[model samples]
Target: MSNVTSNSPSASNAVKPLDQGEEAVVRALHRVIHALPRAMDAELLREQGLPLVEYLTLMNLSETPGRRLRMNELAATCGMSLSGMTRVVQKLEAQGFVQRIRCEQDGRGWNAVLTDSGLARLEQAWPTNLAATRKYFLDHLAGLDLEKLAAAMRKIAT
Candidate 1:
């Protein structure tokens, strides 16, 4: 989804390679994109028994007005497939951390509702998540212009 385009001088139109600086940035960004989540996930799982995806799902639901979101909406918000979100919700439900009910506006759709237990669990894991985020990601940005970095990231995301 990046706006990057192939720049080929040859008739065959093969894509040109990134310059050294661009390649370095791309590789580092890609590694951080993956490694950060795995590091945080491992920490959370070890310390709090909650996977990063489940925490994100619960956190997203908690932020909604009624602490609930339609399954598809939650999936989008969490950047997960519908089936993946369903499985995470099922696990959370089995743990008594969430409840699934028919959506009021459309009974055919299900909503994931964060329960009291879920909130407690999130709160319990919040510190660990925060610590891991700081350790694996934030601390590395010590003197950088965060606003600019955030803007760049937003641009890439869009």
Candidate 2:
């Protein structure tokens, strides 16, 4: 097997230098796409009393049948690790947003179910979430650009 090193001369030589305009575009895209979510998340989440990840988890649970999902499945859907999910769910449970129940079929597994309060929170938060999403994201991109961006994201995700 060939070993790769960050300081290797061959690796350095293989990298093509980005031009000024390309660099500017890359930097601007990174800043706008990455920073906008954080800013919007902070503002919207603070007002709604939940973080973006928590809101997304609640929304995901709400969409499921009986507002319940297996812990492993929820982790996959949320793009989080099992341990990370456990922590989030624990916090939600503590706050009366969700409940952890033993899986019916599997004794070792657990399910996360959205509580009524969770549903109520989701209903109250949806408007601000939708408006912020539209204002910061959808409204800025053209139709063609949006399609292209979605396609690119799908490719990267897979």
Candidate 3:
């Protein structure tokens, strides 16, 4: 009664030769993971007036020896260009959150230091940020799944 051909395993299917279900699953996983950082960044920016990139830079400096890191090193750690990092540092400096100083070992190089204000801001944001991460990401995955995902990501990243 129907014109459509029945191409079960008995007959050769004319459609796609291979199933793309795995690719679809991979893409969905990628999207969910990618959306997380963007959402967290938006929340922090809206509530604290600190962009994620700026916060990451400040946090990195805060954890470093003397709460200072060379400008280039900070840029690399934050995955930003030197000029982009300079602009962010300028904004942080304006807000009294950070300061740029000459590197003690190399006068030609500059360092970005996280100020008390910067540390305080990070402190204020950290709990909520971490909670959001736990609620959205960690709480959903089993320990084994987390471990597997981490291993898979590390393999891909390398």
TM-score of every model versus the real structure: 0.89, 0.77, 0.77
TM-score, candidate 1, is: 0.89
Q: Give the winner by lDDT.
A: 1
Error of 2 at 77 (Å): 2.2
- How many residue-pair clashes does candidate 1 contain? 0
Segments of candidate 1 deviating more than 4 angstroms:
1-17
* Order by TM-score, highest first: 1, 2, 3
> How many clashes show up per model?
0, 0, 0
lDDT of 3 by residue, 41-62 (tens): 8877777776788878878988
lDDT tens per residue, model 1, 38-97:
999999999998999999999999999999999999999999999999999999999999
Model 2: how far is 14 from its true place, Å? Answer: 6.4
**Over the stretch 1-158, how does candidate 2's per-residue lDDT look in tens digits?**
12344776777776666777878877887799788878668867778877887888899999999999999999999889999999999999999999999999968999999999989988988887888888887787755577778998899779
Question: After TM-score superposition, what is the CA distance of residue 33 in candidate 3 from its true location, in Å?
Answer: 5.6
Candidate 2 steric clashes: 0
